[model samples]
Target: MKHENAKYLRPQHLSGLELVRDICCGNLEGGSVGSTEVTLTPGKIKAGNHTADPQTAGSVGLLLQVSLPCALYADGPSELCLKGGTNADMAPQIDYTIKVFKPIVEKFGVHFNCDLRMRGYYPKGGGEVVAKVSPVSELSPVNMTERGTISKIYGRSFVAGVLPYKLAKDMATTATRVIRREIKDLYINIHTLQEKDMACGSGNGIIIIAESSTGCIFAGSALGKKGVYPDKVGFEAAEMLLRNIRHNGCVDEFLQDQLILFMALANGISRIRTGPVTLHTKTAIHVAEQLTQAKFTVTKADDENASNDTYIIECQGVGVTNPHF
Candidate 1:
């Protein structure tokens, strides 16, 4: 019902449960979640622009995550605009969500796009993000296990507000250096951005995206915090991406859970090989099972010839239909 992370990002006076209650049930006369028991009545969802302001520097990425499913089933196209932290600690970055996450969802026959109007960091929190989601009548099953060949590696480094452009460049340089050691012929390009008009205040970070010949794109990113060196941020981001690459997973660690809900909603069985199963993945499976009549199985492959044990997630979908039959 409540979590430490939720407590940190939510308004200090409002509990996470209370916030959800207010949003879903609407607060009448300042009544809290406990004031009344509201039953959710299902109906044909409307298509239009929906917006929210988290009030805290909460990750807009997370907000989008919860909204995506509902949007996908809307009677018509839906658009969402969220104002909050576009990039924050322990949350998915807008770049990764756009480049890596959305593409994976597309494989399930869901079409959507994310556009970041302005970057938002912590403290000042003034970022804006817009998402356009197209309704889907059905979802397709996926069976991805190969990572294919390394084709190109590129990155984007951004510094907002008062940060120097050199910080972004340095982070890209450091990250490229570490990644080059793994694949000598790999081409690493880094784009540096120093924008004075950051909607969400000041911050610096880098995101490295690896594109494979099979069209699978994986990403790793690091956000700049007080006292952290730019070079270190680059190195860490590079290392994270490299680790994911070495694992030979079709989907990166952070993406495994994100794909689960779609897989469970698909029309047929879906399977994928990924890195070690994370608690987040398990939790997603649990939630998916509860939401739909879907079944999930996780298996760990033990092969003496393989460097690391791989995780396999298999899902039998509930065949959820769009526009509600």
Candidate 2:
């Protein structure tokens, strides 16, 4: 008698998973694991009021397993696996996996260790699997001023489909124009993914970051299908950075020249500029209010005649406050 080979093919990279991780983790500089497995089994399919009758009646099913590297999860492993009675619903399974992982990777500091043990087929079949998890250090804090060093801008917008490249470019141009002086050394990146349109536009999200003389700034924006103007997304992000700067009382000719120093202190400081004020000026009372919840000191200039002419802000939790928590 002759035996047949099972033909075990290796799993390929899942772009969906990578995209989710990138969106969540901000930058791909954090710690990660490699070559984790994911297994799936088949389950009964309901037909209207009752379970669907099997045509053959004999055991009929399929199994699926995938292997991929851990992209995010600085603290421990995050599980990625099939759900919803994993029968033939590949699309739903994938969607659930993306939803579960996206927010987890973005909000928390955990790693992933996926494992696929058994496989299942359609028409009432089932199996079991496991995913290992571990923890790593939290990602480094990021700021917004880093945009000064960027050169090119990349923009990606996901509506029902990919928005026109021209539209994305227009948004990028607007962003640059709004903050031209603030973002020269940074590169802008934009991409649109259909996966983001999965359900009532709940999956839609935007991310913005900049690399400056100091370091990097990571920011993100998300929108549902039924709310807000999409065109304002990038502009809003730019404004947020501006507000953060103004709220911090760090907007001054001197501070701008010495951005590296302030950038280093951004994680430690809370309040920034009130608008586009300069350094060495009396800090604004608003700065005190804003930094009240942060970790930096709020400083203001006492003399109204000083040539520095900078606004004042506060840093609520410098050296002691940890944004990660």
Candidate 3:
């Protein structure tokens, strides 16, 4: 769909689908998402190499979020060559999508692998990523009401283009120091890196993650801005992660919404424990309900020791299967 106000977007690639306009949205001067037309073929959308060029610093991660689900039900597998921002200010960072979202989505039985080929920053966007998704005939439901043990804490602080590598190291050092002060007995490792090749524009960002033994993942991230101290960025990211840890939910707030569609499409009942419901999650739930026959319920979790912020999201999926698969 091409809107007057929308930026560029990549079309979903399925075996049986035909498309004239791929995810090539507007130029640097963004536009709205007013779709003019759509065409379809006999099988699922034709799966193959596709590209999404937002021209501006639009999000490649957002492109995947819109297309990956459709690819799962495709006639075959899909390989996407996405180009745009890897670490946008508004969308999920590429790292969070890979590290946190990928694991949780795989639990539903579909699998995909992503490799960042280049680091794309805001304004003049020139990042690239290659993602391969394996088609699944049916999806399995998930159960993750318990947060379980926090097995590990790890992160990465990255700098690219004209950004100094010292900034990355500074962010990592400060974040490690902050987290260690709170939890003393876990393996804490935050790596600092300088993007050596094909890094578009100067940029820096930090991501901190906590992985639960039960497969739940939570994360916090902070982007480096002009005039902001690297140490302050690290402190902010650590604090964001710590706040999620304090929630004690099975999943992070951001993860809550992303799973709604999968839960609605899975084979059985799916349940998860999460922190406060985000507006994005609510919107996803509404969209899922409108598009599928799935039923969803949101209620407070029955844990006396838990804080008031904890809640349970349960979905009765329609057990939809791929007809072409």
Candidate 4:
């Protein structure tokens, strides 16, 4: 299938390892996957209700992340019902996405409302989320050159099913202790939630969010695994947040890549100063450049006061307008 607009071209197809070989050899013809098929006809995106159930116990945050941008192109408001693991390992927790990730994108003019109907964990996947997305005519460029003082830090330490409530309390206490060493006057408020009613399975995790005076937010998290102690999880999350603050970057490490696409769509130039560039950030830059046919530049920070890992990314946006396909 093919979707074409002045801003981008989307070739929707299924592929496997063989498809990689074909692309490497410059063969443009498509390959097949399963019998599942889709037929596309040219038309404006219509407002409607959509349901997605990713049968696997994969992270619902991953599914929502991929689908949110597409929803913004709809001609009218869109409502989505998603089901899967709400707090699975190796993916951004749903709480972080809603509180941290969504707000960052909102700075660029994306509008959406989400509610977690039920919490899902690993091994048994039955989580439900509802999101309402509104279409936008255009996205604004974001200039986050400075991340001012860290005014406050807040977090949630939650446990569900069989875990003891003390686990969550201990996590909050441990994390607060670690953060106070760096910022003597810092206000760290960690809430503890131990609920047997909301979760689909047994799990515990902590999500920390740091708010800057300039409205930039940096978040860090740690999940509890089978053998990991609750205190260790709390300590790790605090350490991660401290590391990001020490680097003096505008956003946390993981968020740098997430903003690339929005930056490419904005009007005029968009610049971001961030910590060490990861492969994910590099890949996002490549993908944005390829899809929008725009230019992005990466430069290392030369200031003696800056950390060696500091880098600056600049991009010339295509000025994606409303009524985009």
| Runs in model 4 lying further than 4 Å from the true structure | 1-44, 303-305
Model 2 worst lDDT run, 10 consecutive residues:
44-53
- In order of listing, the candidates' clash counts read 2, 75, 21, 1
> What digit string (tens of lDDT, one per residue) describes model 3 on residues 1-325?
2223233323222211221123221122212233333232223355666666666677778778877887777777788877778898878899999999998899999799998888789877788888898888899999988888788999999998888899999999999899988888997899899986868998999999999888889998999999999999999999888888776798887788889999999999999888888999998998899879799999987786468888889999999898876
Which candidate wins on TM-score? 1
Candidate 1 vs candidate 2, lDDT winner: 1
Off by over 4 Å in 3: 1-44
Better of 1 and 3 by lDDT: 3
Q: What digit string (tens of lDDT, one per residue) describes model 1 on residues 150-230?
A: 798998998988888899999999998999898899778989888776455889999999988887778889999999999
- Cα lDDT over the full model 1: 0.78
Error of 3 at 212 (Å): 1.4
| Each candidate: RMSD | 3.7, 19.1, 4.7, 6.7
The TM-scores of all predictions, comma-separated, are 0.88, 0.32, 0.87, 0.85
lDDT of 4: 0.77
Q: Give lDDT for model 2.
A: 0.32
lDDT, candidate 2, 129-150, per-residue tens: 3344443333222232212333
**What TM-score does structure 1 among the candidates reach?**
0.88
- How far in Å is the alpha carbon of 292 misplaced in model 1? 1.2
Residues 1-325, candidate 4: write the lDDT tens digits. 3322343211212222122222122232323333233323323445667666655456677666666666676677878777777877878888888988899899889999888998987767678789888888878888887878899899999999898998898888889999999888977899999967777888888999999999888888888889888899999989988988787778888788888988998878888888998899899999899888768999987776468888888999998776644
